[model samples]
Target: MTYVSVQTQIYSPQGWDLSDIYKSFDEPKFEQDLTGLQQKVAEFQHHYRGQVSQLTPEEMARCLQQLEVLSEQYSYLDTFANLVFCANTRSSEAKQFFNDTKLALTRIYNQLLFFNLELQDLDTTQFDELQASSALQQYNHYLNRIAQFRPHRLPEEAERTRNRDMLTGRFAFVQLYSVHRGEQDYEPVATPDDKQVETPAQLEALLFHSDGDVRYEAYCSLHQEMERHNGLYGFILNAICQDHRIESQMRGYPSTFHKQLLAADVPESVFRLIMDGVSDRIDLFQRYYQLKGQAIGQKIRTCDLNTPWTADDPLLKLDYKTGVQTLLNALKPFDVFYANRASDFFSKRWVDTKVRPGKASGVFSFPTFAKHSYLSLCYTEDYHSLFTLAHQVGRGLQFSRTRDRQTYFNTQPPLLLREVASIFNKLLLFDYLLKEAADDPLRKQAVLTRMLEDQFNLLFYQSTISRLELALHERAAQGSFDHSFVNEQWLEFYRQLCGDAVEVLPEHQYDWAGMSHIFTQPFSSYQYAAASIVSLACYQQYQAVGKDFIPSYFDFLAAGSSMNPVEALRQTVGVDLEDPATVNGAFYYVEGLIDQLQAML
Candidate 1:
């Protein structure tokens, strides 16, 4: 609990007020709501369990309307459990409550799982009749989505069995990793003096610090800690990937990736297209790294990929107040709606930015079914944190707006578009910075360098992760992938990505072991690459169309999961996910960025 941030000359860091979720976890209403939820689930099961297929369209719509209400309550309880646990990961009470709530949700969800299965079970003529009904006017998208899963539906008992097994199975391992991440503290890098860090987030901050020795020491220490636990992390990753592979096989999917593509409502063809696109255009990045070596006065290593290329870059340490204001000003050019909604984030305590002890490691915005979102991130005084704040603000705005208008089932935007809105806002901020620093060559160069680094992270780095995941999953389907095999594949991805422009460290092979997402969600990292493509196109469209792009973009965000990603992107950004040219266009855009940076240099 050391290093509690205090008020500085500019502003103070603060935590989000959880009052909007509940006054306190122990509030009487918390218990009352849990009890009420139990009763409602019982009533719903009694009313709708086996009768879903027999109901008329009006009855079915009414049932769904009621189910949405129940879902909101479930969402609130789950969100509360998660947020409380994140703030104090060692809290036994929070742990127990979150686990108990998850069990309860699974049970209730099993009861309602029949709703979609039964609707999907209807014969085609009757299903068509249901879709044709006026009562289903607003529920068409939800019904159509349920229909999409019809071919993948398993026997009811198997689905039920899997639901019950999740509590003690793969999901338990996720918590195991969380426990490890939360309790494990790190020794910070020495700036001629060694210091222990209070949070892993602070330890990670060193990797992007202005000191090379500090970055190296911290990188070694952090990776060594995770390396020591490689067996446990490997087990977690293997078990999760195996479960996914087995489930996909049982669900009649061709491969493990087919399932994730299904969840994203995208096709395998589109994923491949984007992957090949990014892979083909990695030369600019190779050149960028060469430029990095020139700027930093040394040959770049894998660890040094994170170091800033230019030392003369302007170091703008934006505090909390200034950061929020900066986001609003940058967003104002795109649309006032985006700017104003982001402003609400500060006025309403919707963000948790205080870098304190026992908080989560990374940044993410939690979207609630209650039509509001909460952002949690470890804020530092750097461009990375500033842009991340802006990033989550984009997600917060999307979730709040989507939930306000769409039904609970349809409120979540597809993963592909979810990253789009966040990254689009990020590009806007970058544009603003470049414009602001036009008079200063060094500042603009720094901005370009930073932007290039981001492109590398999203396009090259994430795409490599995706490639490793695919290779690992394919290999895992054959048998268990051990520590050696995993490490070798990890190193291969690094080499494949950077080619020979940067040196590789053997210790860096353990890097994949530390990525929590690959354990929790394999095959999902590619979505960042996919979304980056859509974002580049969106930004380019914004430039060409000017203010006229706002309404289209707004409508795109508001669409949520109502349409496929390809359709949405085509309509809004005029980019087709299936087209090879669309992929080539994104690479060309990155090349243009390198052109700008090279000219400036």
Candidate 2:
């Protein structure tokens, strides 16, 4: 089961082929596209810079079409640079190329700032006329979304300055944190034969080790390294919050979180409702942890949260090919087309699963509107890896559908809806695994425990982090704070969530510094909690309606940003986020799972 032994096997993990994006960074086509994008941006600015307010509906449609084309070209270059850099963050060449591309794209974005600024200048009657026109129907969603920012829009020069400043300001700090994290080598776990963990992914995998001491050491090693750089991490986080607060005030947002809500196209009340719902269910979350501790015959410590249910539990292992087949088989029974769409990621070599040095930690599906999205993973050939693959493939499928059905302007879904498909896929995979282990009590129990752990991670854990983020923002508004302040706030939130069910270790304070999302995507963790609730609700509908639910589910995925997330969920799945019962229903599903787990005990 050693990583090295697994690597030596015949079916060694595969890395994705970037040939579809570009054969190489310096390829002729890449250079041509770079130059072509610059030319197009110039032409676009020249033609439509000041004419948006005067354009007729047909002309407005034409302008948007041109902008879409420009966006596709820009995405191609930008996505390529990012994918390359993420693959090997330690590569100096990759870093330089990524920064260079960002600079070029920022300049282009600055050049085109006038388009939106001028659009915001249109009189209400003119704007209403354009929206009511048939010719501009396709861009109705895009136009409305842009209009939502009208009150917050700055002057053209100010907007351009903000765009350019981001490269050196907030964006630089984010990059620094990513590189600093990716380049670290954690101290080896002694009980685990002194194996050196080179990346965060490897250290994370160790948390699931059967040996309790090994898990604890790995956890300490991770937090200790993070604590070592707490000062830098704290500074980056503070700067990001300050920047957000300053910009929010200048834009006249009612609150710091207002801008994020507007971007998500979600109402503040909906977010608060979801957060409150999860907060009310902390007892259920803690009860599950207590049950987990009983099953494992020990008090659950923070490090042991992901540990195996028993020392002798049969660890579910699957090679990459078998894992793919398992996922495809589970998906095929749900929908042949869905299975085939996921299969394309494998058959087309669009997935990178190799665990290698310098590769980015964790898994993500990098998306591009102009091309098929690519998935990255550090697969370890375990059930966790299989589930990770399923989660990411779900993202790939959702993006695939969006790319097929929506225009570039509407391709990216809001953050709240982004995880629906992925979480649904995990739920489906969980059911399939549980069914496969029906005859073996231990195996079935293992599967059930894994699902419960995932639920808590998504629902309770993310909710806690989201609350901590809000607290950090609130504190930042009052004055500046360092890593010690962050630690105290995180510990407080952690204690509130876990209660007496699990021990909150001192090292847990440093855990906040390791969450990339807090720094990279502020105020986003609640979306995971909210999406989990929505996904569980979707799963309940699927179970009740059986195959009849497929069409609407597909429609939900394909809706993209064309519709509001709340409206889309209500229309497609009959789940209303505005209703408290929706959240209650999702937790009831969790309660059923806990009841089943209790019976097994």
Q: Which ten residues in a row have the lowest lDDT in candidate 1?
A: 1-10
Which ranges of candidate 2 are over 4 A from the true structure?
A: 1-10, 190-196
Model 1 spans with C-alpha error above 4 angstroms:
1-10, 192-198
**Model 2, residue 239: displacement in angstroms?**
1.0
lDDT of each: 0.80, 0.86
lDDT of 2 by residue, 105-141 (tens): 9998898889988988998889889889999887888
Model 1: pairs clashing at backbone N, Cα or C within 3 Å: none
TM-score of 2: 0.96
